[model samples]
Target: MIRAWKRFAAYVLISLAILVGMDMARADAGSTVAPAAGPGDAARSWAGHIAALRARA
Candidate 1:
């Protein structure tokens, strides 16, 4: 009774999770969003900040 209900709930939750994941994958597959930054952009940005701090000090 209680155990059977728990098992059923788990299966239902798992099935819903699988369906949601599949839907998300399909949506992302059609996305055209571009990358936010190019290679070395983070490093360049960090170096710029460090240079500014040194100049301030």
Candidate 2:
């Protein structure tokens, strides 16, 4: 009935909000952990490595 549908909608909205929040958190954390610029390619390589590690976790 209408009541059940309303409950279902609320659950879906809450789940979506949680997912978005987690994604935003990950992005924020990654930005903070990013390596700084260097003279050569080493910094870029390290950044990619760190990103890969994060994705795995």
Candidate 3:
């Protein structure tokens, strides 16, 4: 029983470590791109068109 408990604990710690490493990797992978107003403006325009179509429905 003790041996089983030890193995379980080890597995849990290793899993947690792997998850933390993945999270760190993802954070580091995040974009460094500067935000532009053009994309937001385009999206807003598209959304307005969609809303208009939805209103017709």
Candidate 4:
């Protein structure tokens, strides 16, 4: 169904976004963007958020 496809697409997009964010965070490492706790850590948390969205869909 169209709805199923839409859900899958959304999941893929969210996964990609999180990956890109982590990469960017790593690229800026040690330049203040990385932060003491690391920037990509939040990206991992986004997986949970996106998982919820996918589940809802």
Candidate 5:
């Protein structure tokens, strides 16, 4: 019936939206946007290592 079809369409749209939002969030979660630091920046290097460990956890 038309009502059933509409419900199915709505469910599919909502599922697609959730999938897209999760993908976007995960993509952003994977990396930092900070400018690259030189090798002399020990603090930045340590912070980067911590971030990598946290991401793995």
Candidate 6:
């Protein structure tokens, strides 16, 4: 009975470790395409525009 319990514990621990490793690997593998940060990004930032307008006033 003790032997069976030991084996069960080992299996559970190994399974958990494998799951954690897979999650870490998945996080490292970022999306294939990078997000678009094109030249007009700054131009489209409404908050910055508002701040500029406020500063001018």
RMSD of 3: 14.4
Relative to the true structure, candidate 1 reaches a TM of: 0.53
Cand. 1 Cα-lDDT: 0.61
Off by over 4 Å in 6: 31-57
Model 6's alpha-carbon lDDT is 0.57
Task: Please report, in order, the local distance difference test score of every candidate based on alpha carbons.
Answer: 0.61, 0.66, 0.61, 0.61, 0.65, 0.57
List clash counts for every candidate, in order.
Answer: 0, 0, 0, 0, 0, 0
For each candidate in turn, give its C-alpha RMSD to the true structure in angstroms.
Answer: 14.7, 9.5, 14.4, 10.8, 11.2, 16.9
The candidate with the higher TM-score, 3 or 4, is 3
Residue 32 accuracy (lDDT) in model 4: 29
| Distance from true location, Cα of 21 in model 4, Å | 0.1
TM-score of each: 0.53, 0.53, 0.52, 0.52, 0.52, 0.52
Give the per-residue lDDT of model 3 (tens digit) for 1-57.
999999999999999997665444434545232334798865764455455445545
Off by over 4 Å in 2: 31-57
Best by lDDT: 2
Writing each residue's lDDT as its tens digit, candidate 1 over 8-48 gives 99999999997665445434445333333966865654455
Residues 11-44, model 4: lDDT tens digits:
9999999878655554444222432355577675
Model 1 per-residue lDDT at 13 = 100
Q: In angstroms, how far off is 14's CA in candidate 3? A: 0.2
Q: 17 in model 5: Cα distance from truth in Å?
A: 0.2
